[model samples]
Target chain A: MAKLSRRRFLTETSAAIATAPFISTSATRARAQESRKLGFAICGLGRLSESQIAPALARTRHCRLAGLVTGTPAKAEAYMAKYGVPAGSVYSYDTMHRMADDPGIDVVYVATPNALHAEHATRAAAAGKHVFCEKPLEVSVERCRQMIDACKDAGRLLGTAYRCQYDPHHLECIRLVREQVFGAPFIIEAGFGIDVGGPDQWRLKRDLAGGGALMDVGIYALQATRYLTGEEPVVVSALETKTDPAKFAEVDESMVWTTRFPGGVVAHCSTSYKAGGIQNMRVNAERGWFELDPAFFYNGNHGRRSDGQEIRFPEIDLFAAEMDDFAQCILEGRPSKVPGEEGLRDVRIMQAIYESARTGAAVPLA
Target chain B: MAKLSRRRFLTETSAAIATAPFISTSATRARAQESRKLGFAICGLGRLSESQIAPALARTRHCRLAGLVTGTPAKAEAYMAKYGVPAGSVYSYDTMHRMADDPGIDVVYVATPNALHAEHATRAAAAGKHVFCEKPLEVSVERCRQMIDACKDAGRLLGTAYRCQYDPHHLECIRLVREQVFGAPFIIEAGFGIDVGGPDQWRLKRDLAGGGALMDVGIYALQATRYLTGEEPVVVSALETKTDPAKFAEVDESMVWTTRFPGGVVAHCSTSYKAGGIQNMRVNAERGWFELDPAFFYNGNHGRRSDGQEIRFPEIDLFAAEMDDFAQCILEGRPSKVPGEEGLRDVRIMQAIYESARTGAAVPLA
Candidate 1:
């Protein structure tokens, strides 16, 4: 036919655009032929980056450390040299969005402190990139929701670094709960605690770390309680402790809390910064009790249970499986095992726990 | 002496008795170089007594099985034959009181159903013997208090069997919690559950066993939580379930409950009969966490950590220690390790749990 009227032409073009596929790097790229050579980038290279995350990333398979981002050029160069990172992939915080322009960078793992996660994640999403955010998902439920929204708006996926979810021992505990091996689970007992003495540590600052160990480690148990019981907490009651006025001036040193579910399941949990480093989770069911003696983070020794058999994970790296999971989520367009909403829910519970602790009453989660 | 008025003679006799030095049993009786041969009598030798108490006594020192009292004469005879008990010591319920006249029996172990414990223990006390009663001293707090009163009236000691309190794993867990190794505890998670195939057992009878698994097993965890925390619970909230109305006709099959203590520590606990066997407890403190993976009533396996060293109680005789403690309490005229009032408080808490479970509201213990 001849040239159409202006309105008809505009309507036809809009319809064509709506029907066509939208392109994103994760969706458009071919799967790397070398299954063991996947590429990934490090966002917010902080202490964890230097101590555990970067080192673990170097040792992981199905993925390799490919790029770095930091405001400090010297630190970036050092990180690149330590991990054999490529030169063109280095990015400043201001120019991190340009990382999307590099085809070699497949995923952006955000290991920054609590407050910076949203900004980095939003920028990465705007660049049409997948994101692996660290814990607390930007310090608040609202921020977590916004990050999720941003990822959805950019047609990308988001994953949170709750490394415990990838832990085999934790997985077995979850299985026992879900399969009713212990019978209808009636209670979950869990906690995370450490003697983090340094006053200058980022975790001691509410603005940078969100709250306390509750935000950092207790969330592991909270998320685990939900995953294990397969029930959402309906009400929460809690208590807070801050022994040293000056050292833990900004955040709580310890927190004890309880969550009640509709199906009569209760989770009793606690987190502390003024205590010795120990992590554990136990579920009591109708049939029998199943437990992981020591849970959460440990390096020298670890244990898991599979089909009633206790399996030890000696000298295992938690960061490897966590990093691999993030890459797979990016490559497959699949949802993360611990998704953005899981992080949001955890933050919501954390907020409720604080509110309850402050008010000396039980706070209901609506 | 000159004939005196009846009232004066009675008063003089009382004065003479009171003025006389308190008799040391050793002075009136012959002393043996070996340890005193303590003899114990078990009443209502059913499941717990047969499976745990009797076998445990066999493995013990400082005590030996001297007699058995059963409602069924056949059971009494059978048990005596199997345990190599003396022929003069077997008695039925009706004759149990007279069996206390037997000189060989120094203590009575009340392992009867909940409802019978009060009567059996009271009679044992009246016969001038020490009493070791199984958990939930009586069906009700009023009855438990009565048992305490009777034992005191008779000048005899009353001890409730809280086996886990003597277990090495649990003892270490308690030490860490009380020492604040995990920090000032803010939350407690305690639970006990077992899958009992609806065997029409006495425990399912409201009149005989008092309540459900809560009265039988959950009380152990509740007592453990309180003993470990050394704090009284001020408020209680609970939910109860019985999926199979026929099986759990007069009792609850499952329960989820909570307790709030003075320092804002909250214990969220559960108990169930339709689940597999599980025994676990956790304390979350301001500084750290203390937990027992295989917490209560384990046959052999147990583990804990204290003072930076892992303590694994591969195998130990908990019952022997429990019996020995009772014996020492009696022989030394010291208070029981877990005295009658402690049992009374646990019963009070249990009653509150049931009431809260029924009312769907928080019941204040205070």
Candidate 2:
């Protein structure tokens, strides 16, 4: 085993720097299209939209922040003034459908609460815009299906905001597992959690957040396991724990779920709002293992392998990369790697997990 | 978040170096007893006994390899010749009871197959020798209970070779969790696995090993979870997967189980014979989190805290520390910290996990 410094490894791997062909193609397309940027209208001017997505749009190669849709006029005014957007480009949630008449908005990025994802995404698709919805795609599998159907019927693309799909370190992990670099992965452990703040938050409400930690953070674990194993889990068993009942009266504070994938791959995953910080994914294969701690973060993700190899992909704006990938898919007239169907698969598994937890029995997935 | 070098941290923590009083007492007792070492007769001449326990006994200050019991005459001769033991000190498994007449052997350490643990430990105890049995205690709870009762009737101490209990890094983790240094632990993820070889091996034989990975490596995760949370799980749910049915016809190739403990703590654990290497324990408490990766190894175990503190305890001979701890307890007339009951608790939990796996339902532990 040889020790490789993180700096050397990152430089050698070229981190998230796009390949030559991709850069050349993007430049050629820009020259042909007069450097036209894909105009994005961000729905829901909340913390993530204001702090992460808006800034990420500025950093993206082919995407531009062109419009805003918010229930709060004050937020709309602030965003418009900050981004130098015209008054005509701002619309309230109720008036968002009118954007079908506007050519400035090519994509509607839905960054709303969980329950509103389906509604927002469907409306955006009907308004003749491609839909880029944040994760959990929607509250239920049924809503996810509806969102997907709406986008298909309206001839628009639906891309889920699974940012890790564009992250370089995660991409390397996926490639390694797919290539069987260590041998077939037999077990996967992935989890994500955060110390959530107050009971009054939308995430604590069952109607708003759909579930709890499983809905918010556990999705990352589910996605990681599915991607790592390259198989759908056949069965799922889950357990729920709530230490502070009053604080989590309507939703679970923590959840632990086990899934048995097709090839004897078993995943033990967990998420919690009451517990301290954790974000990691470990895959144990027949010959060796590899893992990423802080796997799903925007930056500072590091990975190592059993063979003393380090995975040190350079840091990139995860949100920027995600938006750019979606833009590239649109420009290429191709489906997204993280498509509506990919989001649907996760929601279906999550539904089974909830069912298993509720019944206290293993639930078979379709 | 101060970064302390491993050397500095180990020096500050003193690793497993016992305080002055303990060292002085051991020295004084050795002098008083004319330097007579307490003798340990290992009951099996298999891989672990030959490779780890015998060498560890040589390193222990208070214990010495005094006798050997093996069904194989060749193994007995080899061990006797290697250790320079008298022929009278070696006994076949059938003649092991005759050791009752020998005064040299003070403790009998059972490192036999799981199914033979109870019979060997009971026979050793009936011979008026203290017993130190390797993990699981026995194949079943009934056998563990009988072994415990036999030791009690003979007025002999019964210890389980849970060496991690004496490992300084694990000890520090236990201390932190027990002392609530990071508030009450709400979630625990523990797993142990190795890529085991050959279907003909004793570990794959259900009759000899009792189970598959759960009987072997999985017990480590179960024990670690209990020790870290300081609580017994009330209910368990499990799922088993066997990808290579031909290779694992009699037992599971992999298993994932979840347990719910008192006070809303949930544990997610997994083990596999076909999986790549993984031995880790992570505890998520209300205030923060901490984890030990490669936790159960004899050496090179490292730990980290949520506060960015590294637990850099110096490497010690884990087997030597464990044997010495047991010898010290015997000399002091105190009970072993990892007593028969501690092993019984884990065995009970394991039984529940197996039942849950069999029925695909949550099984409650009484």
Candidate 3:
């Protein structure tokens, strides 16, 4: 690798994963990789790709928007025209494997529908590109494993795009809890809710999204508890509520879960499509407590502690932070702070939560 | 019943149980009851009795501290001298039945150790006087039932001293949620904790307090959820932590519970003896959320809503409110809002929580 200053390579993000970048992925092309910014081809022109990720890539310091993969021509044309990419850099999803011949794209960020993640990620790996997939990782553990194994077999890194894991506020919260700044946290209450009203959206179709609020928003709460506690839950129980049976016939409208970590940390998490404005996370520690309101928002997040301390961090573009970090990982030939395994852990736990909710019992993790 | 014009017979307590006061107790002493304040013999002389309850009694408009029942002569003499009660009005616990012939003591408020509550309450009932017991009711369900049966057998109205049930803040909170002022409530997060350091105290002894923070302070959180949601839990789960095993060998040092109520409401509650200064309650309603800081405090309780409405209510002397409400119940010939059955419900649910924590499963309520 080119001798980039540790200053340029290191950035203020999660103290919890500060040492992750030093891990040796041992990519033989490290020398070539270090000379230029990592190129990311966003593999789906969905709303997130059109709005947050693409706009964020425009401002990232270490990552460049290199190519587009989409089923629709207008979206591809618009993104290509907007980003100044060559027409040869664009490919339809069916022909994305041809990108193996192109050297412009070093990574593919998969932001497809839930059930389609495994296919896109595998294709990206098979095309000799690192894979960065959005959350839930996929709909099931088996699909996530397929993605993980495909990337490993292809000798390319696989990253899970956990944006909050890179958000400054959540990073600071992780620092506080991991360092025991207010003593050990014993209880975590976290959740996300949005009154998503699209009746025909994929998120409401069980086949497309896999679940309802628990899949779309509840995963945020589950991830918050895991990252903050730095421990996977040992036992989990859940209860679900569905106010409109007709509207949510193919999915769940709301869900609540109770989880117990090995160290005796307990968490209560909830997610809902019926009740909005519920993005918050509270950690009750030994000496005091700290909480974030509007916690999981894309912006304007803030927090405070019980001892009159403000939990503030510098402003950050979440998408840029995540992508830049992934770029650094690629350059260093290391795995990301949020890897495929982390996403797989959450997916398996969420499956247990659903089983518990259905059976009205607590499910213990092995 | 009293001809005391519903003005004196009615009160602003729990809106959830507002209709309880009109139920008839049929004491057959209404003509005698209407002429004077109800006389109460405080059956314990502990710190709570000396500091809060005694001073609160001095200010109660509908009740009088007419007697004292203590094994120690010094405590008996001190209370009698302070309250101006005659020597004959005082009785030792062993001989408390002797007061059955005396007209000065119409009710006995049992504030003994948790394990002794049933004994004292049953004794009071056998003396043909009404019984008002402190929170927890008893150390176990069987004991609580014994007290309830004793009162029923004696044809005496039995009240449980759930002080917050009469706290103005909690009552207003109940009114808001019960009235659906913020649509319908779906989630409740409540708890109380004080770092009581006495390792030799009855609370840590297990036998006296039955459980540690779960019984001592977690009950406050349970009662808050019950009153605020106006529903009993359908299933409950718990996790317990003991930071110092030796210090808490016989009792839990900290405990957390997740409960699902009928009507799709779920609650997360916690209590700790090792972590202090934790008192708050948040209710997630359909349209908005309301929360209280210093929620279960004896004073200075305040709350606010997500819409920026301050959750303020008139300041209240908690002891006076509960005792006066009991007095009104006796005078009106009806059960108090927090009846013995209410306390029994909590004790049994607490048992389920402990069982869940032990077995790592969710316990369903019958």
Residue A344 lDDT (model 1): 85
The lDDT per prediction is 0.73, 0.82, 0.82
DockQ order, best first, reads 2, 3, 1
**Candidate 3 true-interface contact recovery:** 0.35
| Whole-model alpha-carbon lDDT for candidate 2 | 0.82
Per-residue lDDT tens digits for candidate 3, residues A1-366, read 232243223211211122233344456335434445667889989899988999999889877777889888788888877776657879898999998866667789998888889999999999888888988899899999999999999888899888999888898899999899988888788989988786988888888888888888889999999999888898888888766778899888878888888776888888888777679898888788888887988888899988998877777899999999888887676668899999999999999999998998889887
Model 1 has an lDDT value of: 0.73
- Scoring only the A-chain of each prediction against the true A-chain gives TM-scores of 0.86, 0.90, 0.91
Q: Give fnat for candidates 1, 2 and onward, in order.
A: 0.33, 0.76, 0.35
Which order, best to worst by TM-score?
3, 2, 1
Off by over 4 Å in 2: A1-35, A198-200, B1-36, B198-200
Q: Per-residue alpha-carbon lDDT of model 3 for B91-209, expressed as tens digits?
A: 88999888776566778989888989999998888887789898889989999999999999987889998999888788889999989988878777898988867677777887778
Q: Write the per-residue lDDT of candidate 2 for residues B1-366, one digit (tens) a residue.
A: 132243233222221222223324665544523434567888998999988999898898777777888888788887776765557878877887887776667789999998899999989988878899999788899999999999998888899999888889888999988898998888888888877887678887888888888988899899988887788888899988775788888877788899988877889988888865678888888889888988877788888998999987878899999888898776666678999998888888888889988887789885
Off by over 4 Å in 3: A1-35, B1-35
Span of ten consecutive residues with least summed lDDT in model 2 chain B: B11-20
Which clashing pairs does model 3 show?
Answer: B25-B333, B303-B311
For model 3 chain B, the run of ten residues with the poorest summed lDDT: B10-19
Worst 10 residues of 2 chain A by lDDT: A11-20
Pick by TM-score: 1 or 2, better one: 2
**Could you give the CAPRI-style class of model 1?**
acceptable
Write down the RMSD of all candidates, one decimal each: 9.3, 10.3, 6.7
